[model samples]
Target: MCWKKRFWFLWNARLQPPMPDASKGVGHLWNHNALKGYHYFEIKTIRSSNMKRITTLAFFACLILSISCNIYKEKKPSQVHPQLSPLEKYVAAPDTAFRYELRSTLPGKGYTTYVLYLQSQRWLSEKEVKNPLWWHWLTIVVPDEVKGGTGLLYIGEGSRKTELPTAAHPIILQSALATHTITAAVHNVPNQPVEFTDDDFGPRVEDELIAHGWRQYLDGGGTEADSKWLARLPMTKAAVRAMDAVQQFCKEKTQKEVSRFTVIGASKRGWATWTTAIADDRVVAIAPVVIDLLNVVPSFQHHWQAYGFWAPAVSDYVREGIMDRQNTAAYQRLIETVEPYTFRKRLDLPKFLINAASDQFFLPDSWQFYWNGLVGEKHLRYVPNAGHSLSGSDAIESFVAFYHAIVNNEPRPDFDWKTADGNILINTDPQFQPDSIWLWQTANRNARDFRKETIGTTWTRSPVEFSADGKYKLDIEKPAKGYAAFFVELVFVGDGPVPFKFTTGVVVRPEEMPFGDYNTTK
Candidate 1:
């Protein structure tokens, strides 16, 4: 390539946030072929011989460096642990099968959107081709202000839509504009409501397909490899391949590379965000919303204990008979292959774990089973009045704020919190001050369940002040009748467009098991 083309390539490729060792400068750029044979000494020689040409080159290089420094202030790459390989295999295995076609482009307010029909992969084997091939409508929204090698990838859920989107999702458009980075949303995560003829399963999506996979492994005498072909494999691969598609599209459109991503997903897609972070090294941060049931075995046990029955949200697993076969070796193998908790050690990326306090799918206290086991910087929020749908809440605003932080390399709030001796203790870093702090609590006098459907909108919040000892604490008084769940939430309004919210894990008072331990049935 000519030097001008090379410069464009280098400008587009290296002109984003600097990685940690980025200050190594021209020599490092040369090592990466950003300037194949050029070095600092050559620049010096050019400066002595040709002032104007050297000045132009010098100005260009400095612009790139300054932008890099300004965007991510020595942001470090995520540490990828070497233990997990099954997810990696599933992602890379279907790469050769990857393809996409730009179906349409829609001009939007302050942004341009590209809609492509993407065939992310052909999952499963030929014998299992009775199911549909993995296909999706991948939408890439690039704001007029977009500038960077980092972008956001949102894993979304829906049945296949053959027609192209008339416009991008409003939140995605807003995110691209707010974050000033390309944002992509890929739908049909599991390509769902799918029917597998060989397995005799019909019209399954989300947890149904997952439950089917678990049953196939535990009860159908399937091997660990068979478990690898479960719904999560393809679901996760869709996001990975979506990243590949976005990078390739950006390269073609602007000669730029999207080298890093902050992934966001909700519910089943949120679960994929965890697996995708483990599977792909490019993920710098993750916001997993409403899919709090990590550490599956213990989480489920906690779920059963909380309600004295499997909540209707998890009936798919129960109907699959998976609850009865947790002891089997096949089930263990399946867990190791797909459970986010099993690969928690590999998830060193920054994480924003958001869930609903009244989620019908999971208990408010489910974080206790897996939060500490996570390996890196983490934040949490249990949206007080929200449930599995998170409707009528400002949850999306939090997601946008967290994404802005990741893209800008903003420091997360510093704090340590724990439930101890029936009280929640929080010690905030002196540098981090909250705009407001409140204690959110609710009571379930009749049963242990806290679902909004059963309990209505009974959660209430009260202002809390730091104690004289300088620690923020909330004492728990066991309810005289049944159960009370509560947590302390701190809200910080950062320089970003929205406030950042974090919380202590919800603690249920009167620590008593209302039901027997790990029963097979309600």
Candidate 2:
């Protein structure tokens, strides 16, 4: 219903003339000639006529008064007319939320993709759908073989196809979970269209509803472009709305409740993923890759971080410039409203943080305080010899394995690592022995001299031996380049050859800087 409303008004009122002289008992004159003087001359002509013409003018005046009163009543913004959001339609069941344009199945995959316009909450909230805009939501069903009650929702500016004609494509549905992965993606709201004249009203309001941002704006108030009350941010609102639709669709279409759910994203979307995890209890897990911005304090520092990459996100607030970037209250307010780390103590869900030691965006050490503060079953995987590529690596499989364990009521594997003395200790299962354990240098991940034929090289091993307690100790000197990453290389797990279940190579760096890799950036 919000997709069909039109907001347009005709201009036909005249402007009042300027004041003449208040001392002469004449200030201003009310003129209703539509500012073209046509009605004014017509009235003059009628006044010169006889009594019969005046009586006719009186009748017309009464009719015009009645119409004006009716129009005024209709124009008042306070009159309440409520409407349901897109997710609400699935619950209420009259197809009020969405209109499907094309629905087809992916070839050989048995997954369905739907191209449709999702009605926005702006139209739903303001009544009559006065501001209506359309965008596509690419919905992909999990493969037929793995039909289960778990749902993963991805919201990002992903790729698109001609059939769906959108920027959102399924990033995770094709992974290990695809056998039963149901996914929905909502694109960044379209650039405000050209024809929608109400720049900040209607469905367009949803995009601009978040006026820059401030701590008070989290729950939604402030003097914004509208009435001066801080505007509500649609960032988290839009995410929740789209996810609600995805879960609801999975529930109704599959005739099974999506008992387990996870929200996944990278970068800024990672921020949304964590925010979504905290806001919604149904989300059993959250995987936010490479973006670690939590209770951002003034003293926080990232030494290995390249300069000029640190731009404060809170600066987007309308009044942020009023105070300096170093202002403590400003930083605290930002943490209170937008930072998910502010409430890290209350979280009880499992979270998988896929990061890399050499990440260009966020330094691994920069995440210590925030990551440790999480009150959840947290997993921080900082891959050695890798930068941001961890997002596409074995991390994907780990996520699926984790969700599978969760939905099937099983246990997820642990990659426990601790460093002491001169060796890395790995608590093993006795039966599983790593093929080799190598200490790597971050600056040297690019070139490591080794022979191709041999799987085990003495150069790669640094006098490492296994002890009776299952801890592997390495007797090696630190690299000269100033950074070290280590991994326990296990024999490749393949069909029938390995006795491990859901096992992959485990990597970890020290809580503090490792040997030969202390911060020397000046």
Go through the candidates in order and give each one's C-alpha lDDT. 0.74, 0.42
Tens digit of per-residue lDDT, candidate 1, span 16-133 = 3332221222011000000010101123525366788878887787677646533432332111213335655555442334566676788877878998777666766657545456
Instruction: Show the lowest summed lDDT stretch of 10 residues, model 1.
Output: 26-35
Give me candidate 1's TM-score against the actual structure. Answer: 0.82
lDDT of 2 at 155: 49
Candidate 2 whole-model C-alpha lDDT, 0 to 1? 0.42
Error of 1 at 401 (Å): 1.2
Q: Taking the candidates one at a time, how many backbone clashes does each contain?
A: 0, 9
